[model samples]
Target: MNNLLIGYARCSTDKQDLQIQRETLTSLGVAADRIYCDHGLTGTKRDRPGLTQALAAVRGGDTLVVAKLDRLARSVPDARWIAEQLTERGVRLQIGASVYDPTDPMGKMFFNILATFAEFEADLIRLRTREGMKRAKAQGKLRGKQPKLSSMQYKELRRMYDSGDYAISDLAEMFRVSRATIYRSLERTPVSR
Candidate 1:
């Protein structure tokens, strides 16, 4: 049987478009139907349905095509593991227009270099995000999920609870809030307030 060119594409977030990668794969001669994709999945994540399907779809003599090494994997170990699997199965890896020959020392070196950079990029992104969040928190702008009840509403809820006439269920119904919310409010406020 003739070898096939199976393409794999991925986007880390749902907002990120996969059309460009798909077009690139098509331009590289991979059939549209043979292209697989994972949407809203980061390369750091191990469980990717598209990557699994692409790996399983490739047989001996078939080639797996990706737009870039980073698109295939963001970690060195994962990249190496995929390369090894392809090598053992007699499958070729095509990154962009170039076919990676795992047996070649230069190809192996290149793959490793590319994988390291991909991992580095991912690390840098994480660090930057953490720093941004930290700065926002310090500036008092990163207050996590806003309270469901307004401060005035909470005071009123507490007042109703302190009346001794309203049960927790009655207070929740009166406030149009959950019983758990009522319980939490009661826990936070001392009686007679």
Candidate 2:
């Protein structure tokens, strides 16, 4: 199985092309049939069918190849998990021109450092998003989508519901809103606006 090389490629969506990764794998001498791809699927998701198939097809001594580290996984833990699985199965992991050798201390150190950077990058993005949301709220532009019913309309609906003359279904129908919406309206405190 040492001669057997399996390649995997992924794109975030159907609109994205796998051609570049495919060409890279081909140039690396992996047969077209041996290459697997997940289209319109995010790298962050572990449930990719194409990746599952490629892993299943791997045999002892076979090499799993990808064009880049991110193409294989989006996070550090995920990349490490895949690498561990390959090591357990006696399969080699290759990224672009370099083959990862976990047994080599330098290689292990390099991969760990790279994975840490990827995780740090993701964390930074999340922090920036939180800051942006805070800024929006400060500007009074952070209100979510407007309610289906205006404040006055909701007050009227509440009054009708409290009277107990109308069934919830009937009120929902009259208001042209879902029963859940009516229940939510009943639960809410009076809105000034």
Candidate 3:
């Protein structure tokens, strides 16, 4: 049976471009049709549909290709798990231009090290983001989403509603806000019994 190259690529955010990885895989001799991709999916996730398809496409004597180790799996345990599965299925893993030999002791160590680094990098990013948000908040720069209307605006909106001179739709149009916003604003004031 002829061996085939099944390529997989992923990006955690839709904003991230998978074009480079696709180009890299194509350059590595994988046919465009043979490539599967996951957009807005993180490496920390194991249930990626693209990864599943890629793995399923590879049979004995077939190779699974990824642009990088982190693109395949982020955690050490997940990496080892995938490696073991491939080894048992007699499938080879190609990371970029390098073929990872899971049977070799040194190869296993290297793979584990790479996975550890990927996990560490993800953790550091989370830590840095939290720290930055905390600092921003302390400086009063991170007050999330300012209210659409001021307290005075709410009072005026409520007064107009109580006057009964304007319809709800008219009030919304006059205030340049939605009917729901008008309702919410009016609700904020207690009704007089």
Candidate 4:
């Protein structure tokens, strides 16, 4: 059998289309049968079902093609880890934007440098976000996320507790709140009622 040329494509959300990426890979001589795609899934996650299946299907001489590096993974660390895994298994990775072949020495060097930069960029973003949150907290402007249930919802919760038809767990699920919230709401009910 001919050495397989597998392609992987991913989009962050269901609203985004994978058509363009799929077309690009298909135009690059990758066959339709060998393409795996994950829709409505974040690239940061390592447990992508389509990606896992594609990786497993590849053999020693097979080539794994991605439209771009970022499409495969969100961070440099993840990219590097995936590259290492493919290399150890004698599989080749071909980034459509670059001519670097992961199996080649020059390609490996280039990929490592790129991965390092990616890691640095991710760390910088995280640091900036943390610093921003800290400043907000110091200014007493950070109230955190707003409460999910409104005043009306709280009233309904009280009524539901009074009716005594549903269990606390059921009320929690129906109202999309925690059991603790339900218990607290029930506690606040007037003794006469």
Candidate 5:
């Protein structure tokens, strides 16, 4: 069987475009029909429909092409594991921008080094986020959204409740507040003019 060039493209959100990646793969000699695309999905997920289909279609000695290393996955461990899987199945993994190729010994070494760096960068980001959250909590800066209802609004809510024209849930929905907020407002003394 002739070696087939398969491409995979993914975008994290529906608003983002996958065309550039697709075009890059096509320019690199992958046929338009051979490119599989997944949109509005996260790379963190393992069960992507397009990715699964692309993997299933690939046979031994096939080349699986991606626009970039990150386009395949962000996690270094996951990336390494995926490379291993492809190699075990006799599939060659190629990154358009990276010198790392699973088919070559030097490329494999370079890929491992790059994966290690990616892992280190991810750890740093997680550590920085944790420290920032700790500082914010210490300063009492962590807070939820403020209540939307004003005292006058509370009065109106009570008046509407007294009318009994709407159910509790219905009143909550109409006011755009939660049922708990409505019940709490009902417990308060209605303000006089």
Candidate 6:
């Protein structure tokens, strides 16, 4: 069918619902049969089966539509690559009401700008998360995960390691942990008596 509209929707986790995206795409005139969805898959993952299928199904004049650009990809490289792929295939990509016309230089520029903003937003989120963690640590509220072993246990581990009588595997078996955990415990300072 010429001038077909195909839609894509994605949810990042199993707990998330794709209903909102589905509704939006349906309202935008994408037929149910024309809609593809990737469930419980991150935008960063390149192996999304639904996206692969959607891309494979598009024809020269067909439009691939999404509720939002982020639903397509959060990384600029991935977004730009996908846009280039569509351009090469003579397919149009649309996000909400905005369409990216690969034939138009201004449309390509706008799509690049959009992808840059998306990448920037992701970096800002990461920076904010790191800063928040640093502030929490400064306030003494950001202790990481509780230690798997107690101080006494760690001290005992170090003593056992230094004695050379027990193998790392033996210590791991004794402590009911992996050899890596035993090794990590051995690196701790000896506990005071």
What TM-scores do the predictions have?
Answer: 0.72, 0.76, 0.71, 0.64, 0.62, 0.88
Q: Against the true structure, candidate 2 has what lDDT?
A: 0.84
For candidate 4, report its TM-score. 0.64
Position 122, candidate 3: lDDT: 79
How well does candidate 6 match the true structure, expressed as C-alpha RMSD?
2.4
Instruction: State candidate 6's TM-score.
Output: 0.88
Question: Candidate 6's residue-wise lDDT over 4-94, tens digit each?
Answer: 9999999888999999999999998899998999999988898999999999889899999999888898898998888888898899888
Q: What lDDT tens digits, residue by residue, belong to model 3 across residues 1-193?
A: 6589999999989999999999999999999999999999988888899988888888888889999877888888888888888887888788999986667788778778888898898789899999999999999999987767888887777777777788999988998989888888777775533
User: Is 3 or 5 the stronger prediction by TM-score?
Assistant: 3
For model 1, what is the error of residue 138's alpha carbon versus the real structure, in angstroms, after optimal superposition? 3.9
Alpha-carbon lDDT, every model: 0.89, 0.84, 0.86, 0.82, 0.80, 0.88
Error of 5 at 91 (Å): 1.1
In model 4, which range of ten residues has the least summed lDDT? 184-193
The residue-by-residue lDDT of candidate 1 on 148-192, one tens digit each, is: 788788888888878888899898888888999888887876665
Tens-digit per-residue lDDT, 96-179, candidate 2:
888866546786777777777767776787799999999998999898678978888788897887777899999889989999
Model 3 worst lDDT run, 10 consecutive residues: 184-193
Model 5 weakest 10-residue run by lDDT: 97-106
lDDT of 5 by residue, 1-193 (tens): 7588989999878999999999999988899999998898876677788988888878888888888766677677777877787777778877884434576788678777766776676668779988998888789896546767887788788778888787889988988989988888888846434
Off by over 4 Å in 5: 97-104, 117-193
Give residue 52's lDDT in candidate 3 (0 to 100).
87
Model 1 stretches with alpha carbons more than 4 Å out: 145-193
Model 6, runs deviating above 4 Å: 128-143, 191-193
The order of the candidates by TM-score, greatest first, is 6, 2, 1, 3, 4, 5
Tens digit of lDDT per residue, candidate 4, span 1-193? Answer: 5467889999978999999999988987799888999999887799899999888888888888889777787787788888887888788777784545677898788778767776676568779999999999899999787766787887777787678788999999999889998887667654324
